[model samples]
Target chain A: MALAIKELLAVLKDKKGRIVLIMPPILQLFLFGYAASFDLNDIPVAVYNQDQGADSRELVARVIGSPHFHLYADIDHEQQISSLINNKNVLIVLHLGPNFSANLAKGPGTSAQVIIDGRNSNTALLVQGYLSTIVSDFNVDWAKRNGKPPPLASLKLRAWFNSNMVSRWFIVPGIVGLLTFIITTIVTSLSVAREREAGTFDQLLVTPMRPVEILIGKSFPGVLIGSLEGSFILLMAIYWFDIPLRGSLGALYIGMFLFILSAVGIGLMISSLAVTQQQGMLGAFLFMVPAVILSGFATPIANMPQVVQWLTYADPLRYFLIILRGVFLEGDNSSILMHYYWPMAVIAIVTLSLAAWLFRHRMN
Target chain B: MSPFAKRFMRLRGLIRKESLQILRDPSSIAIAFVMPVVLLLLFGYGVSLDAKDIRLALVVEQPDAQTSSLTSAFHHSTYFKSITFHTIQPAERALVTHVVDGIVWLRSDFSARLLNHGDAPIGVFVNGVDANQARITQGYIQGVWQTWLQAYARQQGHDLAIPVRLEPRIWFNAAVRSTDFLVPGLIALIMTLTGAMLTSMVVAREWERGTMEALMVTPIRIWEITVGKLLPYFILGMGGMLLSVAMALWLFNVPLRGSFLVLSLASALYMMVALGMGLLISTVARSQFVAGQIALVATFLPAFILSGFIFEISSMPAPVQVMTHLIPARYFVAILQTVFMAGDIWPVLLTNAAALLVMMVIFLGLARHKTRKRLD
Candidate 1:
């Protein structure tokens, strides 16, 4: 208990360490909240309407009026469309031909030429979906006014759990786990390595503390700091972001406890193996980047290849993220969450035991 | 000896010393060399935004030949992996438990309603945990429904009128492969890691070990030490960049649409900005632990999240969009994406390259201003 207090004081008493703890959590929470988004608001669009007909005018008006699109400037001719995309001035350019209304009225259906900048395929695909929806809406409205048969089999898409389908609710829950892992890993990994670098490892081994006592002392500070960090972020996620906590608070805290243990174990292992703080920091980062990528935080795990999918089983964040979304979104109880809990518990045990083994081995 | 010549030799000695230290450190080598290739492979093969094989449940209340045709459309699609349930309860359970991403329900009067009024609205309940994936999955479900309707309309000899046919021109990337897009932006991230992370940690280690005082007592200048420390890592960062571009081209098969010379010049400018940020961080943080965390907080995390590489800066909030302007990786990512994916459109490339240049000047200037031959 005395040793744990000393470890906590070493971190909290340092001016820079306090800044790292308080500033980054608040700053990163806001950064991930406002900045880390996939929504395209005010996507720049260029409009080129050649036909004077009312029907073509209606379609053009519909495209421009959409909340997803913001018209930069209207162009006059065909030759200028390439320049707009090349300049990176616009993501999409809507060009209507001179015979657009005539062809739709009497002749065959004409095409609405939408030139897209496909540099980022994800953005391109999303813009295509939004644009096509607008055109389909225009088509349905046009048919009703023209005394023609309406289109067959429309869809009524209703999103469950998240009614408005905000990406932050999905991301904030995961960020709680992500930020927890980063802080705890950095704190714990730097501790043993800092002592090793300062030549205090020999002094520590000479003390009356047993190996188990030393391990618990070292891990206690990290677990405490991680839980506090996780709680702060969780409160911010609930109140500031207005994300609902649908499930029991007991289940979320249970996951948070197990997750912090797994994180501390991984950090302690890295700290024990590293000769200096630099190696510890690097190893922590090396583990973290892969863990995050494989965790399905930004991208989906199901989209990965089969061999890679098998690797995600070892990442503690993967199971923790499932628990996060399930509890917050699906209102999952402990019974349903037991499947995610045991894997993390097993990881904690395996990693902590490995850390202890590494500690004993390093004594020689 | 001339004063200039003496200064030049001392600088050369410092440079050699810095180079050897970096080469001797295994962790530096690991971070500089191994991390990039590992991240490249992960981003190349593992990280993908393209949604496929979305698990969907088909709830058909009254199974008929018409409903079978509709369910078959989902099974045939590469985008969805589907199973049929007799009632809505089982399908809803699958959705709640994450066994399925979405559910498509076919009502009892499916054919009768379609045959009479033409207003047939099918219910699609989607899991909105991942809104982007949810939208894509919902779009796929809608597509299956529309195609089946078009086929059904043909059988009944009624024209399902789609007023405007969409002619989409997907420029630059015809295959729509995300690897072609992501690998270039990843190079920006790797450069930041190699340049900023290494320089900050090494410099702060010197400060923590009291080596800076020893060097300060020598006649050699601080700027020379700064240049010496930065030069080796600049070369290493450039090497990592080259390896990344090669892997991106051969291993990932991403096309380089622009000139190689332009990419190199832009990378050099961006490397300087990263190194300067590192030096600036090391000046404030006297310990390796603080330096590492500060470098990550200042340079790397911003590069990962705020840069246009992974997330669109334009889609961000107004204040955050303004914040991206300060992040050097954003400009580099813009240039990289333009050069690799879109051809060397001089307007986009030159504009972003200029931003990197201005940022390089400011960061290097701030770093030099902060360093003095004295202990605080």
Candidate 2:
């Protein structure tokens, strides 16, 4: 315990080191929180209302009035539609037909053209949905006001866990897990390797410290630093970012502790295997890139193929992401979390034991 | 030997030495070759936002031919895998437990109301943990319902034409494959990892081993050493870039719409900036750990987040959008996407290439200044 404190103090003693450790998570949280959003707002839409009538004007009004879209262009010619979309001046172009009002009263053949730039098809799809909702809302209101039958059917849609369906609610909790994973894994994996590279490993080894004691000493700082980073991000998510935490604090901490243990164990294994700190950093980088991709931080695991989904079983971050998101979003209980918890616990044990064995074996 | 010839010979020797060292380091080889392939495969297969076969529960409050036909429509949908239930409580529970992504419930008077009038509303509950997916599922549900309505109306011999038939024409990617959007971004990301993250340790490793003093005693100028050190990694990065381009074109089937010459030119320009940034990072941080961490924070994070690769920059908050202009990968990502999907749009290519050249000059100038022969 005393030796672990000494090691922790050594890392924290330098002001630059301490600041590097503390400042990055806060900055990353602030940057990514503001930048990473798929929610469509201020999407520029071009209007080519050839109709010039009241109904067509009303449709354009509703489109421009929605908070999601901005009126970027008012076009008179058909050629402008292609030019607007091609130049990426607008995401979507809404063109009401020449006889839009005349055909609306007659019914059944009025056509409106929607041209979307599909380079970012995901954004385009969302824009289309938002526009469809607006047009359909106008349709329902117009029909009811005219004392006519409502159009085909209405969908009563409700989002269950996230009522507002905010993407940040899902992405913010993920940053907590991802930031801690990258920071702790890189920092600790470089620890023993840095000692070796600096020619201090021999001095540490010459002491009376047992291999197990040395392993414990080394692993604790990683776990401690990881927990600190995690706590900082979690606090930011709750207090600063204004994301709600619906799960119990006890369950959340337990999951975070196990996740840190697993992450530290992996870093230590890499550290022991690496002959130099450069190799250690590279090794950690290699793992981190794959780990973050496979962990479903930015993408959903359910969308992955069955074989790849099975492969994600080995990644600790996969389980950790599920645990963190479930806790944050769903308020999922300990029993439900246990299904993910035990795998992380097993990974922690196996990797830590492996790192310990490798360390002792290298010394021998 | 003339001064220029002498410099060339010395540069060749340094390149040979750096290549030998890179070959000795197994990790370097893994990162150069193996890492990109693994990342390409992982990203190509795993990182897709396109939803398919979304599991849904269909609740039928009343059993009849019309309702059965509607249920069959959802079951037959390529986008949905549906299970039928007689009540709402179990389906709602399924949605809550995440056993189903969504639930479609038909009221008891669904068929009767449709026959009596022309409209019948259905209730939908979707798990919105992933808001994007939930939104897509909602759109798919609406599409399938519309299709069913059209089919039923046609079978009933009613004129199916409606007011304002929306003809949505999707350009650039007619099929709307997510791969088309994501693969171009992968090229930028892979280059950032190899070009910046790998080379970040080269000079720092020398400094950490106390070998910089010995090297400084040699006859090599700073530019010769920097060029020689950067050339091999530049080749390695270009090779990785080609490999990613090939994989994106052949394996993932993302079309290479632009000229290969222009694509390679943009990549080379971007590589110069990345290599210069790496050199600067290694020069600033004497320790390999600090160098690597700084390189990651400076290059990789910004490449992933600030680049309009995953998230749209125009939609970001104003300050972050301004901050993105400083990141070099933002330009490369724009170049890769335009070249890959949208053909040779020279304005985008030239403008971004100019930006990359400016960044390369700044970073290389800073690196050269930092790597001066004074042993400070």
Candidate 3:
């Protein structure tokens, strides 16, 4: 415990260490919260209305009025689509053929044509969904005004857990896990490596501390610091971002403790193997980039191939992310999250034991 | 010998020494070579935004021929894999337990209401923890429901005519494969690694080891020092960029629609900008560790998050969107995506290339000024 306190204070007392600990996570939280959104707001759309008709104007007005699309330009000719899409001056073009009103009055044989810049497929798909929603609404309203039967059964759509469906609520909790992972890994990875580089490993060994005691001493600071930062970010997420803590706090901390243990295990493994601080930093990076990407933090894991899915089971971040979303959105309790808890626990056990063995082996 | 020849000879010697130093370091070689392939394979294979094979639970209160057809429609869809339940309670339980991502509830009056009233609405409950996946799932569900409704309408011998059906023409990328865009954008990210992380540590490591003072004891000028430091990493960055492009082409199957010459020019310009930023960071930081941390936070994190490499810039809040203009990777990403996805459109290429040129000049200018001051 004394060695742990000394190690923690050594990091906390250093100016660069304090800066690294305090500044990046806060910046990452704000940056990720504000910047990383999949919701396409103010999608630039050009309207090419060849039909000077009332029905076409009504639909155009609906699109322009909706918050989803911003009116970029109203072009009159056929040659403008390529320039608008190619220059990226607009994301989508809403083109109404001269026979737009005629076809609407006659039947449903393609009245309006939408030309989209499909550079980003996800954005293009979302744009299609938005336009389709508007067109379907117009069709339903037109059918009612003309005294015809409703076209089809409409869907009563409800998004559970997040009614507004803002991306910040989803991303902020994730930043908690991500920032903590980055900090703990870098700190613990550099700890023993820094000592070894300064030729103080021999001095540390000459003390009365056993290798197990030394290992626990080294990891305690990482765990304590990780938990403190994780709690602070959690509070910031709950209050500052206004994201609710829907699940029990006990479940969240248990998950956090297990996650930190596993991360420390991984870091100690890297630290023990590294003879220099550079190698430690590089090793931390090699593990970190994959952990974040494969964790399904930004993208979906289910979308990956079958072989990749098997790899995800070994990544502790994957399970922790599931538990995080479960607690924040699903209102899952500790008992409810037992399945996630055990995998992280098993990971911690395996990694911690391996790190302890590596630590003692490296002492020789 | 002329003074110009002497300066050129000195610069070449410095460049050769820096080159040898990099070649001798295994970590530098690993970072410049192995890390690129690792990052490329990971981004190409591991990441995908397209949501598919969603697990859905279908609750049918009354089993009928129409209900069977509806359940079959869910099963037939490329988007959904569905399981049938007799009631809503178990389906809701499945949703909570994450055994299912969504639940579709059809009450007992489904067939009666569909045949008689034609206005019965089905309830859809989606897990909204992942807002992106939830949104896409919602769109897919609507598509399946609409297609099914039309098929059912045609079966009843009446046409459900709609006004203004959308005929969509998806330009640039018709198949909507994300790898085409992501692989190109990843070039910017990989270049960032070569530029900021590698170069940022060069001068700092020298300073930490007291080698910079030894080098300064020679007659090497600040500009020569800057050039010698940057030239090797610039080559490494471009080599990494080329390897990434090759992988994007042969391994990932992303198209290079633009001319190779244009791609090379843009990559070279972007590499100079990256190397300049790394040089500037190393000049300011006195140690390799501090330089690495700064580069990670300033260059790399911004390049990843704010560059529109994966997330859409239009979706970001106003201030963050404005801030993206300062990141050089944003322009590189724009140029690379256009070159790979859309063919050489001079407006996009020229405008983004101009932006990179301006940033390169600014960063290189700043590094030179900082280096000269340190020498003085």
Candidate 4:
């Protein structure tokens, strides 16, 4: 316990260490949480209504009135459409034809071109969906105000967990997993490598301390730092972001402790192999980039191919992310989260034992 | 030899020594050489935003021929893989538990209400844990319903009316393949990793090992030393960039529509900025751990998050959007996507290349200013 405390204090004593341990959780949480959003509201749109009729005017009004779109500038001619999109002044152009309402009144349908700037296809797809929903709603409202029945088939949509479908609720919880993994692995990997590079490894090894004690001393600081960072983000999630914590905090911390163990184990394993601190840092970074990519933090694992989906089963971050989201948003029970937790527990055991074995083997 | 030639010879010697050290360090070689390919394979193959085969639960309160036919319409869709629940309760539970991404509920009077009221409302309860997926899944479900209605109408010899026909023509990417755009943006990310994150540690390691103090005592100019140290990493970063381009073209089959000269010029400019940022961090940090942390916090995260690579910059809040203008990767990503997909559009390329050149000059000047003979 005393040795572990000493190791922890050494990390916290330095000014740079303090900044790395304390500053990033707050900075990244605020920056990434706000910046990473797919919900595009008030998307700038340019409208061109050549129709001099009331129906076309009402359609344009409905497009502007909806919270999803904002009227940037009205275009008078067809030549202005491409220019607006090219200049990125507008994401979509609503071009109402001269015979828009005339065709609606007649049997055949009228055409309105929603020309989207597909440079960012995700944004274009979402904009198209929003425009469609608004137009269909207006069509129903117009039909009902005329005392006629609405469309033949309608969909009553309900989005569970996030009713308004806010992107922050999903993104904020994910930062908890990502931030902890980054800090823990980077810190612990540097701990022993720093000593080794400074030539203090020989001095420390000469002392009466056993290999297991040294292993615990070196590795537990990472677990402690990881949990501290985890809690910091968790607090920010609940209070700063107002994302409620529905599950038991005890369950959340237990899962986090196990995750930190696995992360620290990986770091220690890297530290054991590295001859220099630079090597340790680079190894940690190389591991982290791929771990994050495969973890499904930004994209869904379901979308990955079948072989890659099978590969995700071995990633600790993938399982922990499932637990984090499940606990935070879905209020999942302990038994349900254990389905994810046991795999992390197994990883922790396997990696820590491997590190310990490597530590003992390197001692001679 | 003239003074300038002597300086050039000294810089070459320094570059050779640094290259040897990097080669001796297995981890450095792995990071500069092997890590890029591993990351590219993972990102190109493993990560995707395209949604397919969404798991859905279908709840039919009444089992009849028409309802069975409607459910079969859903099952036949390439987009959905569905499981059947007899009632709404189990399906609702499945949605909450995430056993399925969405649930479709047909009320007991679905057919009867369609005949009597000329309409029937189907309940679509989606798990919006991932809002983008939830939104896309909602569209797919609605499309399936519309198609089934059209087919049923055709079987009955009638036409279903869709009031305003929307013609959505996607430009730049005709098929809208996510990989085409993502692979280009990823090249920027890989360059950032190698140039900024990896280069910072090499200089900081010299400082930590006390070799930097010894070098300062030698007859090397600060600019010469800076250029010498940056030269090898620049080659490594460009090599990584070339590897990414090759993988993008051959492995991912993404077309390189623009001139190769344009792509290489933009990459070189962006890489200089990345290296300069790394050297600046090393000078300030003077410790490998701190330098690594600073490089990650200052360069890597910002490049990944603020570069408009994954998230659109226009959608970010006002201050964050302004902050993105400060990041050098934003320009690189723009140049890359433009060059890869839209071909050599001079306006986009020249504008972004000009921005990258300005940032390269700024960062390199800062790094040179920071490199001093005396150790603080």
How well does each candidate superpose onto the true structure, as a TM-score?
0.98, 0.96, 0.97, 0.96
Task: Give the candidate number with the greatest DockQ.
Answer: 1
Model 1 residue runs over 4 Å out of place are B373-376
Better of 1 and 4 by lDDT: 1
Superpose all Cα atoms of candidate 2 onto the true structure and report the RMSD in Å to 1 decimal: 1.9
What range of 10 consecutive residues in model 3 chain A has the weakest lDDT sum? Answer: A102-111
lDDT tens per residue, model 4, A1-364? 8989988987889998788778877788888899988888778989999999888999899889888889999999999987777656788899998999888777445777888877777777778788778777776776676565655667898898888898888888999999999989987988877787778877878889887888899987898888887888888899988886787777787788889989998999888877777778877887888889889898999999999999888789998888888888888878878788888989888888887777646753
Query: Which 10 residues in a row give candidate 1 chain A its minimum summed lDDT?
Result: A355-364
Which CAPRI level is candidate 3?
Answer: medium
Give stretches of model 3 more than 4 Å off.
Answer: A108-110
Candidate 4's TM-score? 0.96
DockQ of each: 0.77, 0.70, 0.74, 0.69
Candidate 3 clashes between residue pairs 3 or more apart in a chain or in different chains = none
Task: Tell how far residue A358 is off in model 1, in angstroms.
Answer: 1.1
How much lDDT does each candidate structure score? 0.88, 0.85, 0.86, 0.84
The candidate that achieves the highest TM-score relative to the unseen native structure: 1
Ranking by DockQ: 1, 3, 2, 4
Q: Which of candidates 3 and 4 is the stronger one according to lDDT? A: 3
